[model samples]
Target: MNRLLLYVHFNKEDSLSTHVIFQLQALRTIYSKIILISNSHLDRVSLDKLPYDIFLQRNNKGFDFAAWADGMRMVGFDELKEFDSVTIMNDTTFGPIFDFASVVDRMDSSESDFWGITNNRAHSADIGGQLRPLKEHIQSYFITFQQRVVAHLSFQYFWENVQSYDDVNQVILNYETAVTNYFIQEGFKYGVQFDTVSEDISNMQNSDFSIFGVKKLLEYRIPFVKIKAFIHNAEKPEINTIFDEIVSSSDYPSHLIVDHMTFADYPDRDYLLSQKTLDFSSLKGSRTRVGIHLHISCEDEIESFLSSFDQYLDNYDLYLTTSLEEVVASFDKKVKEVILVDRGINAILAWQKIQDRLVGYQIAGHFEESSFSDAIDSLLKPAKKIVAYATINEKIGLVVSDLTVSTRTEPIDEDSMWPYMAQLWNMIYPHNEKNLKKQDIYVRSATASFWYRPKALEKILSIDLNALVIQDLSAMATITHSFSNLLTYVAWANGFDFRFSQPHLLTGFEVRRRFESRPFLMVEEPAILQLKSSKAKRIIGYTIKRLKTIVKKLKY
Candidate 1:
């Protein structure tokens, strides 16, 4: 069949990810034509000669629904019936775990007009009053429509009539849930390639067992597996071992999955990588330009900082904001651009000046010398602003203990000079009082080290930092002279909220103090995980229960 595939893609970093590339490559064989609808704020020139037609857009309203609507409009009414079939796909899932062509061919031969690989009832309490899942709809990650269904008036109406929504629940109710029902109610049959519903495949009480069902999806020719599946079982003990086996067996690239989890939710990654099951050598993501801004005020800390930085200095441009020629000469080849600001220039000026020089980069980060070097990636995450956990120094006294790894937000002194300073902060041109109020307005920590998106900090950049207060804050002329403590608030006040970086576990210089093992009973490998089937496990557990009951009865 001559099929047209419309893909909705959103890369928070505005670069094509390895998984998306893999998905597109797989689709090339299945579809006659492909078009990508992206909400990435990227230039067409930078995208180069990506094989498919691309529509780069700015409106990020309805998530996948918005992108789908935009793609349909771009395809236009005349092009609607040009293909034998149409498929709506997105990058939320991680694979074409197996080849997609066989699945497409199978679906094409079937009488079903609209179908997806798997269908699931949401686990949101059913009419029975028991915890039964309801609403079996084809998961929207990959949905295909035969020409008969695609040509229907309802299909066109669904796209054209899509509405904007602030809350995601509205998007699901209208775009995903309601759209599927509309087609089914209008004399159209909907089907799923996998006969098993979500609840049926694995009991709701133990959804982690759904991993086995997903394995069938791989063997039964299901192309895509949702990435969120792993997230749901991230805390499960065997999740790492199971996923490693799955990735290796499926022939899906390992780095794509691991790299995504690292940023998507690094805590999950810590477990997955602790065992080092996945190979990360082939994990080169799409070419992205990220500039970093760093200050060099302390002579003692520079050497220590560079030593830590040299560990992951991979091809990234380092921007230093220091006027000291001695400090610049002290630096090696790693320093790319040194924007010379006077030694007395406050932290705000250094950042502002550096940002002016970092135009066109997708991600820009700022770090203090003491901030862990590994915090670079954590900082560059596609949030409005991201701050490293200031574990020691600066806010060290406020943290209360040396063992504390995260920076905490505390209430500022209301009656003191801070209220006047806050007044001045709100008066900063282009400020957003509404967004600032949404966050902790009187946050006292986390101004020492952080990363922020330059676009989100535009208001901060536009202002002359030196003029914000009377003179450079380094002089500490007044009690409010410590404006550097409020930089986190500046980012927030400018409508750019910040998220905390994963707490760095250990220091570069410190050895992990080893201690004697605590008193505990030793167990064999069964405690980690059992390789037995559910039936076998249940039988063992039931036998144990019966034996205990008999022992109690005899004692009585």
Candidate 2:
């Protein structure tokens, strides 16, 4: 009589229950006796559904490796001596009807050949060649599904020789690999039914039903089988639609109805706004203050502002008013203030109210007349006293210039190429006393070239200057002045003087020679040259002497 034993190992609950059920139902007609080998902790509901004849075990062994090998040994070829062959499987596998019969025939005909099966073609080469089947092998066992009698003898043979319980289990992988190699080395005939249709029970939705009837047979070696199965499926339309709606609603707050903005719907906004208020409370009475007002229309610009601001954490008392929560979250803990308003009417209305209270005039919708004059007047009263400006327009120059001129006792020497050092001084000290009869005391300097600002910095900051010059200049002026105040405060706290002074534009050679004591002949040589017909050398020599005399007077 011919009989068969099917073996399976299952790990997770979902696959253990639903997936394994489908495979068991499919295999019930072919194999004589079905055996399930698994861990004890499986869900009871899933376990109770199996047929009465199914063999079950609670593998309580300390090492899973040892238990698996012991489980194979317990299959007992002696009890099933009446059977002609047997089959082995894993929880993740499901085979076509012919798989069992074909594998058993191959083993019977080959006479003592070991057999293995796989659904992946890639694994065939791996098992045969580089895997050196005897060396590197996989322990996730799936082998013959065939006549019970011969299969029982092979399983019995494997069990008796099992050495160290752990090593025995581990050796299963090597055994499969070794058996594959043995076939090639000894010229033993091996057969693979690449056409066998088997679905990986692990993959449910896209089960491979094509090779459901063919079985791969190897005489002494394990045959590999390949099949395509679906592990993951694309999102269904309902879920995708809901996801898109949520994203759109969250991004366009102004378009959302007020009722839709409830805490349940917009949890992230609620959390961020609460955090902003808490942060604002921490800075109620700070001595010096810093604030960022981002009015950019694009998300990238807002992010860039926040990123650039983060680098100056130690230098500012930072505040932010923007729609970009991601950018704000990146700021340091000391940046303890922010105001949240929507990008539409709420932002404009809030600003209008602020302007009215501080500047004394309302911004009428009309652009024609000075309906907003009172607002500007009110703003000037408070703003003039406190606000300073800084700009990212030519940030490197501005930073380098600030570092240089703001140092009182130790002036930056001329060799430094801090960006816009010259321009920054011109802005900070608009009235150059040397050139001015009286200080002009301008509030802001005229806009100048930032051509030398690093392209890398500019890209990182995302500063766009393509708008009208006047508007761009005003915005940059506001930013630069605000930044300067922060810089001055930081500098002053560090024991460095923060007052601006005019930069020395003198060349290195001229600076060194300015105070050198020239011989009387050296001074007179230029005079003698002036008397001669040579104009160029005379001009240079005379200018050098005059500069030296000026230096001497300044020292005195």
Candidate topping TM-score? 1
Give me the overall lDDT of model 1: 0.56
Residue 26 in candidate 2, Cα distance off native in Å: 1.3
Give the whole-model CA lDDT for all candidates, comma-separated: 0.56, 0.32
What digit string (tens of lDDT, one per residue) describes model 2 on residues 171-193?
44444344344333544333333
Query: Could you tell me every candidate's TM-score relative to the true structure?
Result: 0.50, 0.30
Task: Determine the C-alpha RMSD for candidate 2 after optimal superposition of all C-alphas.
Answer: 28.5
Residue pairs whose backbone atoms clash in candidate 1 = none
Query: Ten-residue segment with the worst summed lDDT in candidate 1?
Result: 392-401
Q: What is the number of backbone collisions in each predicted candidate, taken in the order shown?
A: 0, 47
